[model samples]
Target: MAGIFVYAETKEGEFRKATGEILSRCRGVADATGEPLVAVVVGPAPEDAPRRLAPFGADLVLHVEGPGLEVYTSQGYAWAVTSCLAGRQPAALFFGNTPLARDLAPRVAERMDAALHADCTGLAWEDGRFVFTRPLYGGKLLARAVSRPGHPVLATFRPNSLGVAEVAATSPAYERVQVEVPAGSVASVVKETIRQVAGRVSLQEAEIIVSGGRGVGGPEGFRVIEELADVLGAAVGASRAAVDAGWISYDHQVGQTGKAVSPNLYIACGISGAIQHLAGMSSARCIVAINKDPDAYIFKVADYGIVGDLFQVVPALTAELREMLVRA
Candidate 1:
């Protein structure tokens, strides 16, 4: 059977949240096409990758590892993925829209002569074809795309789009493929990896986000936003204005040029809601805007709006939440 394959990505030996999300959704895609759900793990994958994937609708787990593939080198990973696809010839291959996938997926598509779609936010099976929906013009418009018949399809989906949900667990078999990467295949090697420490959840995986903007006044002003975020156990976010103002780091930025987020609850404090910023978080399940400006654009998309001094309102909101959450 031509199966539906997923590139199961990992961080620190555990599955990334977006990986689980793609698998959970693709489980339906596999069932619709009457094909096995296959997961491909590559490059420093966990030894228990197969065991971990079996309960997530995976019927088969393919582990690919070898010299030059132990760490992520685009050339090395691409070679493994393209080779696995050649042998399996799956109907479609899905990947989370991680930096690694953005680099590797295109290479695989090119190698396999497959149709490629990137940054898809939605997926569905209809009329005997798989449909992928992606944003265009910096998230102002949307477009649906499909692949030509008789061609393998490769797609990358944005994180936090299709959230993880339970799927019928299946006992899955495992296999390993060791390909000695040829010389010159890997152009560069990573000598050391330096990781940043973040006390809160990763923005892409966070269910709730508390964001601040220029109205925050300064970097120290973010303390209130952080307090609110702490009360809700949410991640902290910032608009491009705050980032450009040097009030926060770019890693916390949310905008057209920054990270797109789709948290369950997005709280925007002191943000004027520039279109670019809205483009990043408009898909949040619920938006709460707190701005002193009554006509701020953030109110347009907010599920709840509070027109007042964010400096005063945010602290009060934080205190109230802290008390309520503690009691509950």
Candidate 2:
């Protein structure tokens, strides 16, 4: 029987939020196609890994473990995943559009000779085929694609587009798949790993974001943005102008050149909302802008606008949020 396969990505032996998001979304596709949902997890199998996936609608969890597989090596992972798909012959394979997936998906697709789509934002069924919607030209246009019948479909989706899955009452069956890394398959060895932000939520996976721009003044000005972000449990972001001025790191930048995000709530502080900046965040479910210029371009996309100094407004808002949380 044909099935829908999902790659369950993990970090530090724990499942990433993207794993549950993709699994939940694939479960719906599997139901529509009348196919079983299968999830393949690679790395050192944590004791609870299989259990964690069952609730997300995994009919079977393939736990792939082996030496040199503990850390992410593109060749090793691709080989293992391709081996699992050899016999099952899934109708479609889903992956989160993450750094790891970007590297591994292409290799697996080449091995399976399957059609590949990247950074998809939506999925649907039409004429017995799966339709994948993805952004192009830096999100200026959206393109839809479908795979030919008799060939397995492969695609990766952006984070946060599909919400996390609710837990199911029944548990999924577990299977162990062992991998043997062929000679010359793994060319690089990871001697060390440097993690960024020990436990902070990844920017792409954040449900809410608080961003700043040149009007934030300087490096010290980000303290205000951070304060508000901490209060709201949101990730911090900056406009390209702020990064260009050396006020913040490039990783915090949000624009066409930076990471694209679609959070539930996006609060822009002192940002002028250049088209480049807007491209990265225009998909936000709700936007609130704070700028001294009432005619700022940001107001065009903002659901709510506040004309004032962010310095004063941010502090006051943070204070109110803290008080409300305490009262609750």
Candidate 3:
């Protein structure tokens, strides 16, 4: 069958936020092309997974279940996705530009001899072609690309870069495809998975982020940042300088060398906002910078700037937000 296929990524048995973001974007393309929206899942099926995908406009869900699939192995996931493509070809295959997708999408495209585009922030069907837009030169520019005709197009989207559709009560139809892992196909075994236990939101998936930098002083300084983030239900982020100083773990770092995030609201506390740092979060919908230095480069890109010591300002703001939230 000719349709649109989306790789629904999951983490620890729950759907990743990127799954809904990609599906919502693909839904528009499917509607335009007059094709069914097929969501493919490779792993132990989560209860009500298909029903959850329906709200994002998945007309059908293809569940691929098999041994050696519970933990993500590049080879195993690639093989399973290719197996689902055996009897049918999709107009375009979509995957989130996540770590797993980064490894699996290229492999699947290579197996199918299809064209692939990575880190696409925008996708559109124009003039009978699927045009994908992705950032280049550290997000200094956006480049548009399209695949050759007569080949299945493949693309991976950055998380939170696209919008998510509202949830619906209706459930999509489901189909189960049993995959047989070929001998010698499975190479690595996942011994253990250590999950990060922190704020409610994952940095990549967070809508609001409160980030600190070297100006925060020391490890103890992060408490203020965390308190503000907690009150706002935002994720805690750190500049590369903070991580390098050992004030926080590298996982909290956000810069060219670290994670790129595009949250709805990015509160940069005490960050000088170097070009490298901006490269990672310049795409945020709104940027708020709090720094004592009015000359801080971060203020240049901030939608709102507050010149003050973050220590006092952050606590005051957190207290105000708490009171307002309580009153509401």
Candidate 4:
């Protein structure tokens, strides 16, 4: 079938926000191109995967199930994606420009000898053609890429590039395809998956994030930011400077070289806005910058700026918000 294909990435048997984010946009494109919107999940799929995904404009959900597919092995998962595309011509295969997609999309593209557009900030059908826009020169410029309409196109979409919203509802049908993976098929095997910061909301999926930077002074300084995050139910982020200083783990770092995040709100405390850092979070809907330096670069991009010591401002802000939440 010549249709739109989406990789449904789920965590703990539930769909990740990125899955819905990409599907919601592709749903519109599917309507415009008159192509069926298909979703593919590789792993132990949730029982309600189809029902939950149908509203996002999925006409069909392909649940690829089999042994050696329970954990994410590059070769195994890549094979699963290829199996879905076999015997069918997909107008385009969409993957979130995430770590997994970054690793997996290219493999599929190479196997099929397809044109792969990586790190697309925008993917849309324009002037009756598929236009993929990506950042160039360290995000200094955006280049739009267009390809011939008929051939299979592969693209990786950035998270939060386009806001997520659902389309008209439908009862999506499902097909379970089994592909057996023999041992030694993949170069590496994952024996166990460990969870770090398991209870905390993930930085990428968070709607609000409270981040600290070099100005936090030390690891202990992150406590105030954590207090703010805990009260707001926001994830804690760190600048590369702070991460290098050992004030926080690299997992919390948000920058071009780190994780790209698009949250509803981003609170940068004691961070001097560098372009590298901005590339990751500039897409946030509402940015609040707190710094003692009045001329800090972060203020330029923040929706709200506070020229004050974060040590003082963050605690007071956290206290006030805590009170408000308690009152409510």
Candidate 5:
């Protein structure tokens, strides 16, 4: 039987949601092609990744133990992954379309000279070949790409392209592989690995997010956004303008230069949507936009919209939601 390799990502000794999603997707690919799903998690052996990958359908967990690998480096990670691929030569390789994957996938593809596809929304096996569906022309069109003339066809899937990882059978077997990572200078030197700043959240992982932009007025105005987020049990996000205005942290900024998110619900307050910002979050399941301008681009994608002053609309919305929750 063929095999499909998955790069299970981890942070602070825990598996990221992307890892679970990739493993789940690979389960389908494995069942369809009758290939075993092999997950390679490069980090310390004591990490929680091996245990985490099991329920998602990993048949064999390749634990690549190495020094300083707990911290991510493009060169080190690619070397370790490609080296493992050299031995297994799987039918295809899958990764999450995150910043790390964005940085690492292309490097591995270049090393393996394998066919590569990015931002895939759907994946399937057709005619004994791997086919991928991805958005093109700024989400205006969808294009299909097939692994043309390649072994170990490489694909990176967008986060939230698949749903939450469901429960499965327990305790898949794990194999620890000792890999000697050749030293390199390209690794990201860690000046500091601080957690989330005083305000703002990891938009990519949030279930709900309240984002603010220039229309938010000022740094003080973000307080209202935070209050709304608190009431909704949501995270706080920001537009580039808000970050540029020093109203919020850069990590919370949602745009091309910032994080891409696909939350269950995304609420944009006082933001005039830019293409870059929309590109990051257009995939959200539901969106609510509040802005004074009736012609704001954010309204285009919003599931619900309020064409009124955000200052007035947001407080009223928050108060109403709070009262409704209390009543319930």
Candidate 6:
């Protein structure tokens, strides 16, 4: 039987949701394959991470502690994981397609001469091998790939793709693991990792996202959109045009050049749905578009559409939602 390995990530001394998603997905693979779910955590072990993973489903947790790992370095992190994995020789290496995963996964695959599949939207075992499906051609096509013959098949999953539900279970075992950090790897010393200084939630992790575009007129127009977002308990996002115009920060930009987001509800206000913008948010469960132009590209894929002025429509919608909540 082949063993399953998961690379769980941590942020600000806590396990990120994407980490739990990968771990839970690996647990399913392990049960089906009759193997153990071996999860590896790089950097310091947050006190709550091990216990949090157990209920979600993990057989064994491997905590790899290293000083060099305090901040994310692509080569250093990859080296540490590759070293610890020598003993177990896992059949597959799973990662949540985060920024670090995007940088390090391919490097690890190249080092091991293993097959690599990135941004997988779904996964399943077939014919004694894993089949991963990822979007291609600007989310217009779905590509299914199989791993080549190798000791460890590397796969990175997209955020919000896997729906991992936690259930009550007996706590699993935890093991302390140590690895030697390679000194002569890539020679870029990252002095400090500056988290974007803002009060906004990250686009990839938000449950609801309210996005604006050029059709909103100017930076001042986004104020109304922000009110709607606040009423809905959502984060504000913007098209490339809005960011280019300095109407919003780059972190709030939703497009191919920015961040890919798959929220539960994505409301587009005045966005024309450029291919680049759709590429980032097409995975959203529900889409609502509001624009005066009926021919706007955003309407093509929107589940709900309203042809009207966003300034007027947004305030009315916000008021209604607030009233509904208060009455309830």
Q: Per-residue CA lDDT of candidate 3, range 1-328, in tens?
A: 3888999988877888888887777776777778888889999768788878877888889999987787789899899999888879787888987778989999999998888998877777787688898888777899999866567989988788886866343468999999878878888888988877443578878899999998899999999999999999999999999999999998888878888888999999999999889888988899999999999999999999999999999999999999999999
- lDDT of model number 3: 0.87
Overlapping backbone residue pairs in candidate 1 total 0
What's model 4's lDDT at 124? 75
Cα shift from native, residue 33, model 4 (Å): 2.2
lDDT per residue for candidate 2 within 1-328, as digits (tens), equals 3898889888777877777887877776677778888888887766877688877888888888877687889999999898878988888888987778989999999998989998888777777788888878666688999877778989998888767757463477888988777878798898999876555567777899999999899999999999999998999999999999999888788888887887899999999999899878877889999999999999998999999999999999999999999899
When 2 and 4 are scored with TM-score, the better candidate is: 4
lDDT of 1 by residue, 26-128 (tens): 7877877788888889878887777787667888888888888878888889998887667676888999887678899998888888888988888888776
lDDT of 4 by residue, 220-242 (tens): 99999999999999999999999
In candidate 3, how many Å is residue 197 off? 3.0
Question: Per-prediction count of colliding residue pairs?
Answer: 0, 0, 0, 0, 0, 0
How does each model score on lDDT?
Answer: 0.86, 0.85, 0.87, 0.87, 0.80, 0.82
Residue range 1-328, candidate 6, lDDT tens digits? 3468888787777776777777776666677778888778888767766677886688878888776877778888888888777767688888887777899899888876778898888888777778898888778888998865445799988777776746444376788777668668757799877888367666776789999998788889989888988888888999999999988888888878887877889999999999999988888889999999999999999999999999889899999999998898
Candidate 2 has what TM-score? Answer: 0.93
Which runs of model 6 end up more than 4 angstroms from their true locations?
Answer: 148-151, 166-170
True-vs-predicted CA distance for residue 201, candidate 5, Å: 4.2
All candidates in order of lDDT, best leading: 4, 3, 1, 2, 6, 5
> Could you report the Cα RMSD, in angstroms, for every candidate shown?
1.6, 1.9, 1.7, 1.6, 2.4, 1.9
Measured with C-alpha atoms, the lDDT of residue 58 in candidate 5 is 87
Candidate 1 regions with alpha-carbon error over 4 angstroms: none
